[model samples]
Target chain A: MPKLLEISKPFIVLVEGKDDAEMLYSLTHSMGMPKDEFQVLQYGGKQKFPSFLKQITNFPEFEMVTKLAIFRDADENSQSAFQSIEHHLKSSDLIPQDSVPTHSGEVKKSDSGFAVGIYITPDCSNKGALETLLLDSLTSEMKSEIETYVTQAEKSLSTDRARDKYKNSTKSRTYAYSALFENASFHDTFNKRLWDWSHPTFNQLKTFLQAF
Target chain B: MPLVQSVHFSNYRNFTDFTMDGLQRINLIVGDSNVGKTGLLEGLVTLWGNEEQFKALPNTFRMSYGDYTTSLDSFWSWLHPQRNHSLTMILRSTDIDNLMRAVRYEDHVRYDRDSVERSLQKTPYKINILPIGIGNYEFQVDLFNQLANTKNGKESLVSSLQVIEPRLKGLDYLKLPSSNHAMVYADVDLDYKIPTTQFGHGFTRSMEMLSNLILSGSDIMIADEIENGIHYSALGSVWKAIIDYAVKNDVQVFATTHSRECIAAAHEAMSEQENYELNVIRLQNRKGEVVAINHNKEDIETAFDLGLPLR
Candidate 1:
């Protein structure tokens, strides 16, 4: 939790929503770090990313924040998503010039003396969101079974019905993940309690956050 | 200007050992209920060395509880939950020789400035203390009468009254023939004059507050729940008047508020004035120990921008 105070922190991570904030919070706890050492702020939504960036950078806390990381969903394309965040950073003058990370999980330090990192959901390998990333965390045996169930479920419905029901690839993947948690709500699947941080799928995100 | 730049307290109320530095001209103490916001104000009033305020402590507590039967021992019970401990407060200011200390003993409390004990016999030194709380109509009316007798006092009172009620034309005290005490009256029209009671709490509270500020005359003002009885719309102008008067008279103000509108209005008022400092101190109960989170102007402004609830 990021408190509104004059105290300085070594770094702060900005996420798009509550689920992302909770997951990252649990991840840091599992890594044996004190909760107060770093702060995680929920910036409300993807569209609010720019405004939040501008605010935090201009805020008095900016002097104390040595590193600032942003985490958002890749949605359909990781490159475009990364570009969108880069534009905000550039426009806010957090970074002097626009430069893409040569490799995934690379950290970029802006001209403002703050280390900046951008992590898109689904672990950089997939062109999807957090639900897509969680689906990748499933065991190979469980993955096969879920894929079979989703394929059969799609076939059972009419094409128009399937298109309306599933909508995007991430939606079906989210349903598949939800089914594993006793048919929990869509948000419950992303709960920190449901996450298995040891899974290889989260290694990239873990490394990137730990670098801060 | 004698501004209290920092305060440290030990074994006082909820605070076992708490210290806050970098206080400004106008400090708005805000936090959750029962976080010792009022206790901090009481501690300042105690240290500011006014016998009237010191003696009024018991009455203030009784008024808060709405029980006049409350004992003075109950007031002393605020000296830390642990027994046999002295409550100590150290207030430092910009002037090197202006530091003051207040200590509460088992039997009595002592106030000292520059290592000299403050005598109650003295003509209540230049540091005038005005504490504005609920239900102080009689005291306010007396002060109002004193101010009305002075050449400029009447004009100042009318001007301050018009801040809350623009139709307020004149203000005077009406002494009743049946009783020794006098009641406050507001002249809103030429043919009609209404008692202060009829004008409502907002008007009376505003009049009491502004009168006290003007009469305080280059001293510290302590107001608990400063926004009480005032409309949200009038907060901006009221704050502007407070800041302007405080600046002109070299009066330092310490007030508490649970209203976001009040804090916002104060920030707006302070920002418009040049070279005036506003600090918002947030008290938090952390693991049974009170902590003061001090925010400078820039921090408070940013907190407002982000919609962080300082209260």
Candidate 2:
């Protein structure tokens, strides 16, 4: 249920679910930023993003919002995910008719004078989701160990059984990597034990959020 | 119509320094439990506290928090915890100069020396009616009589009540043979007339709200937990009647609610109206100081769309 009172924040970031919101909240806190400076709204899933945008655009509180950023997972295709959001933005008249930027991760000003940024996660260059991004952020040594473990597991099973069990290389790697952190849920793997702001792996996300 | 454009207060209750701007005709106050949403309303009431209004403060408090004590000492405890500090609130409107200041000791409370003089301006329609929460049955009867006294007032009351209970035909005062005072009765379904209490909680509450809106002649109406006893489905119509009556009578309304349905209903109703202005004020305690965030009509609509939790 929506709250009756809207909490005031200059910037609002829309993510896919509570896990994404919690991760970003942890990251923001680790970077010495106050939680009240920005708000992270979970849209439940990527499919609800367009409806969420329409609602906020129609809302009176969004007028006071200076910046809005949409964060979504690339999943199977980064370009397609980016295009989907771009189409929604253009249709809503949030961006100029001819100014839909070609880059997947660039900030554009809406017609209403609010800054909007779109980011497709697990690195815009890779075809993956937030879990993919988390996997990539692991230390190189841990990454190699997880990959080797997944390979060993794949060889132990028949090719068809392995295919049935693993689904894809990303899922397999995620499972192996998750095992290292006491088999934390995909949502809980981004805790302080596994994430550090000082690590070079977080440079991109840190830079993107700091723009607000 | 006079809108309370802003309100500023210092050392009042849980608020150290608080200022809320861009108040509109209908403002809904919302926040987490115990974040001082009621305190803010009380602060507004205190700002308009005259001798007569001050005398009724205890009843208002009793209605809101169920504290039965009539002494002003209980009211003084609402001041910020810092001892010897004075509570000050300044209300800014287009044409009203309203302020309230009061200091309290362990057992006695007194208005600041200059507060009484500063609050004496005869601003037009400066009446403040604090309904607190539940409307008293006896008070509702008085208001009904006052509304019935004016031409077409009874018809207006019946018309508004029909939105909730279509069977309600009219309202009348009944003088019981056993008692001296009269009680309110609703004429429902053409022939069967029942005491107002038999019409259920919602009917009584709606009657109280409509009668008060008509008879209070108040410039400002403060309703804490305005959604109480009102059905979620009827919220839109109830708000419409409230807004319509408020606008026609030049009354500014401040209401609080923890229910999202109430807020959404108010937003939908306000949007349907041509020129009504509405704001949702969210009170929050950030780092020990109370902060008021004003969400205008558009903002509230967006919040509804995105399922943002305001409480």
Clashing pairs in 1: none
Off by over 4 Å in 2: A1-69, A72-212, B62-74, B77-81, B86-121, B128-139, B150-156, B159-170, B174-201, B231-234
| Cand. 2 Cα-lDDT | 0.70
Candidate 2 chain B weakest ten by summed lDDT: B99-108
Q: Per-residue alpha-carbon lDDT of model 2 for A152-176, expressed as tens digits?
A: 7666776786567665477668766
Candidate 1 residues B38-141, lDDT tens each?
Answer: 88876776655456556666655235442213544567555544544454434322322454444453434554542433432323324444454445667777
lDDT per model, in order? 0.68, 0.70
- Reference contacts recovered by each candidate, as fractions? 0.04, 0.23
Tens-place lDDT digits, model 1, residues A100-163: 3443467776565567788888776458887777777778887788777777776667688656
The candidate that achieves the highest DockQ relative to the unseen native structure: 2
